[model samples]
Target: MQNSTRKRQKEELNYLRDKVQSLEKELETKRHQLMASKGEDKENKAVRVQLRGSRARAMRWQRIAKHQLVEKQRAEMQNLQLKESLMDQIKLARSLQKLLKKNASKKVEGTEAAQLQARLEFGNYCSAASEDSLYESLLRDMDAVYAEVDTVCARHPVMQNMEEGSDVSSLLEGETDALSLEATNSKVVPFGMEETCAAVWRCLSKDHVKLADGTYHSVASSPDCIRAKAITTLRVNTTTARMQMRFAMKKYVEPGRVVITLESASESEGPRDLLHGLKMMQRAWVVIRPVPFEPEDNEFDGDLPSEETIIQLCMRLTPSVSATVLDIPGQRAGAITELLLAAVHRNLGWLFQTVENILMEHDFGATLL
Candidate 1:
């Protein structure tokens, strides 16, 4: 009886030890599952925060794009309205010219009207073949014109004051703006640089030029000024094709200041595109100084903040009418000069468009009527 009782006690003790071990294993598994669930919750929170940030950026960009589109449309509408107004003014001028001619007793009035009419004429029309010599001549004497520009600035300019030691060459080495334009073509491959410079000088000098060897040569000067920031434009009867002009340009910039000089130089086929009543052998130098941009207190001032810019433009051009109907094959003309003028029109307009933009107003001073 004592042996049987001892055996039963030993079995009971072994069962209690096995039960304790199994309970400990189950408790450890529950702890591990709680830790994993916490880790997954943290990861999900980070993803939600990132999604909110991305959405805010997208909303900001959309607002900016919408604003820009509205501004562009408003600018285009203003341009169209101005064009129509100019056309009306031109028609009125034509009617006045006719009325003056018909009145037999108005001799003085008729003569004055004729001179004004001649001035209003788009350009000196001529055959493409004929203007070649003039274009070449203008190119040959281009630099002489700028030489006069230097002299004029030196001899107490009537309008703007010139700083000491200021010269065209100094303007050439201007600080560059790398971010404004992604790609640029500044190379003049067709004609040599020497000729273009010469033409510019000649364009400026309406008088006789003393050659390098001390001899004087005469140049018939058609000196004209183009203001890069002119608010007005000239009206012409020509079509859009006349807007094409071929030229080379060099630009320089500094803080609040810019200098742009361009000359008529062809890139392909030696300016053969001139056969179509387009401007050739053109040259211009423009200087712009930025002023404070501020808002005005008027109903007309809401298009944009009125930014004041002081601009000075010096230019020379000779336009010849084309008698030939032969079209230029893939002619890339008039964009650079046109866009350059338009961009700068705080003071000016085309080669045709710019011509219209800047050459509109005249007091008949030094202009041969």
Candidate 2:
């Protein structure tokens, strides 16, 4: 009985030892699986962190691009506003010229009428001079405006073409049409006085003394010498195309015939001569044609001259006729003012249209991108 009991105890101990060994093997397998799963989780976390960093970089670049775009747009808007202001000034000058013409026209039979006419004429001259000065000021303003535009355009690199996942060059390749237009329209002052004088002389009638060097020595002892000088000087710095044609077409005529003649003289020639001529003409016109002129019965016949005919007449004539028929200073002033204002309007329209087309092209490109 004692031996049987000892055998049973030995069997039980062996069975317990086997069970413990099995549990240990199972625990080891579970630990290996858990370690593998933890390694995989860690790898996934690392990948997720890298993805988050890439997304942040992309977002940062996008914000920078958006800021640049906004700044560019704001600058364009400011330029447009400045251009509009210049247009407004031109319009105001036209209005003032018209008022002066009307005031000068009422027949001055009595002292009161004469005094009123004189006062109105004086006011007209002052206003016209003021307008002219303003126009000259705009020339300076235009340079500054164009410079600003160039600076902005240079700083902000416009996207000519965009691509996805391509290595974009730091300095994008792009081109602009602004330079083409500027090159074509750039004002060049005539090099020689003889060339300028000849151009002016050809526009005047044969009866009108042909001037040498833009200064006509009056053989005809008429008070109209000053008047003639004013008219000649006004047209002196006209564009070669316009000068060749002589008379301003409906398209070219400005209000009050205030032709802003631009001469491109270098510092060597000195601005003195050109400025002196301009001052003399301005003074003469202001003094002589203080009021706007009225159209005479003979001036506008049933057989109205066509634009081409008028242009030819101006070219063929000894001296170009001032648009205003008024013998009085004020009336001529008013008429010329109307003619010049029309020119300003035409030029502004042209400039605006060109700029708008460029912007539209950019917008289209952006849409494609």
- Highest TM-score model number: 1
RMSD of 1: 35.6
176: Cα error in model 2, Å: 51
How does each model score on lDDT?
0.33, 0.28
Worst 10 residues of 2 by lDDT: 308-317
Off by over 4 Å in 2: 1-56, 59-71, 74-76, 79-87, 90-94, 108-280, 283-369
Taking the tens digit of each residue's C-alpha lDDT, what string does model 2 give over 1-369? Answer: 223323333433343344335435554554565466558657855754565457688688667757865775575554454444344434434333333333334333453333334434333432334433433432343333323332332332221111111010111111210000010011112112222222322322123433211222211222111111111222222211111111111111233221112211100111222221111011000000012223563385766332100001000001111112212221111222222322233232343333334444554777899
- What shift in Å separates residue 354 of candidate 2 from its native position after superposition? 21
The superposed Cα distance between candidate 2 and the true structure at residue 329, in angstroms, equals 22
